[model samples]
Target: MEYISFARLIEAVYLPQIIYTVIALTLSCMSSHRSSTSTELLTAATVQVSSDNQSPNSGNPENTYSDIISSSVHNITVIGVYMVIFAIAGNLMCSYFSGDACTIISTYLEIGGGVPVLYSMDISTKIKTALILSLTAFGGLSALFQSRDMIRISGLSFIKYTTGKIVCAFLCFIFYMMCL
Candidate 1:
C-alpha cells in the first residue's frame, strides 16, 4: 500500500481549483488596471478633442474614476463566468473520485469563488466562501439529499433541513445586499 500525503491529496484534489482562483484574482486585478489606464487615456483624449471649448479638467477626473469602477465591474463579470466553470468541474470531479471531503470542498469553493466575482464590492472572499461552506455542511448534516449520504450519519430530518436552508438563504441575501 502507498501513502498519499495530505499535501499531495490537497494538491491532487484542489490543484485546478487553486490555480483557477489565483488566475481569477490576478486577472481581475490586472484587467481592472489595464482597462482603467486604457479607458482613461482614450476617454481623456476624446474629451479633450471634442470639448475644445468645454472644461477638459472636469471631464478628465470624473471619467478617470468612472473608468476604474466600470473596469472593475467588467472584470468581476468575467470572473463570475470562470467561477461557474470551476463549479461544474468540481461537481464532475466529485462524481468521478468519490471523495466526500473533496466533493464538499469543491462545492463550497463554488460559492467562495463568487466573492472575487463580486470583488469590486466590499465583501471578502473568505466571508463568501465560508458562508457557502457553512450552509452546505449544515444542509448535508440535515440530509438535504438523502441519497447523497453514501456514508450515513444519523440525526437529520427534512423539517430541520428546510429551516436551515431558509435561514441560510435569508442570511445570504442580507450579506449580498450589504456587499451591494
Candidate 2:
C-alpha cells in the first residue's frame, strides 16, 4: 500500500511521528480496550449518563477524548523521542564527512539522510535517483529496527519484513534503471 511506502519514506522527519500515531490508534482500536466488552461498558456508562440527563457518546466529549489521548500517549511519546534521537544522531554523524562519503554514510545510517546526499553528490542524476529510490524502498537499518520494535508482538517475522524491503528495493532499482 502507498501508506507502507510512506512509512519507510523517512525522508520526512515527521513521517514517523504521524505513522506512530496512526499505528497506535489502529492497535488501540484493535485492542481489548475497544472490544465488545468496551461497548458493553459504554452501554452501562450511557445508562448512567441518561439517568443524569446526558447523551451516550456525546455527553462526555472530554472523557472520551482524554481516555483516547491518555491511552495512546505513552507509546507515541516513546517512539517520537526515539525518532528525534535518530535524526539528531544522523545529522551529527553526517557532519563528520563531506561529499560522497557523507552521502554513503548517511544513506547507510538513515534513508532520510540519503535523499539530500544523493542530490548533493557529483554523481549522475540517474544514479542518484535510483539510489534514492532504493534507499526509500529498503528504508535503511533504522526503519527496520523501528518497524520490528513496533510490530514485535504482531506475529510478523523480521526476516519476512526485511525480505519484503529487499524485494521492493530491487524492484524500484530496476524500475529506475529502466525508466532512465
In order, how many clashes per candidate?
Answer: 0, 0
Model 1 poorest ten-residue lDDT run: 146-155
| Decoy 2 TM-score against native | 0.52
lDDT value, candidate 1, whole model: 0.48
Candidate 1 lDDT, 65-167, residue by residue in tens: 8777986887666666656666677667767886545554455445454323333333455444434434433332223332223212222334544554545
Tell me the spans in candidate 2 whose CA falls farther than 4 Å from its real position.
1-67, 95-102
Every candidate's CA RMSD: 20.8, 11.8
3-115: candidate 2 lDDT, tens digit per residue: 22444334332333345457655875888756666577567656665674443765588977876787589667765665666667777877776567665656755666566
After TM-score superposition, what is the CA distance of residue 46 in candidate 1 from its true location, in Å? 30
What local lDDT does model 1 show for residue 99?
A: 57
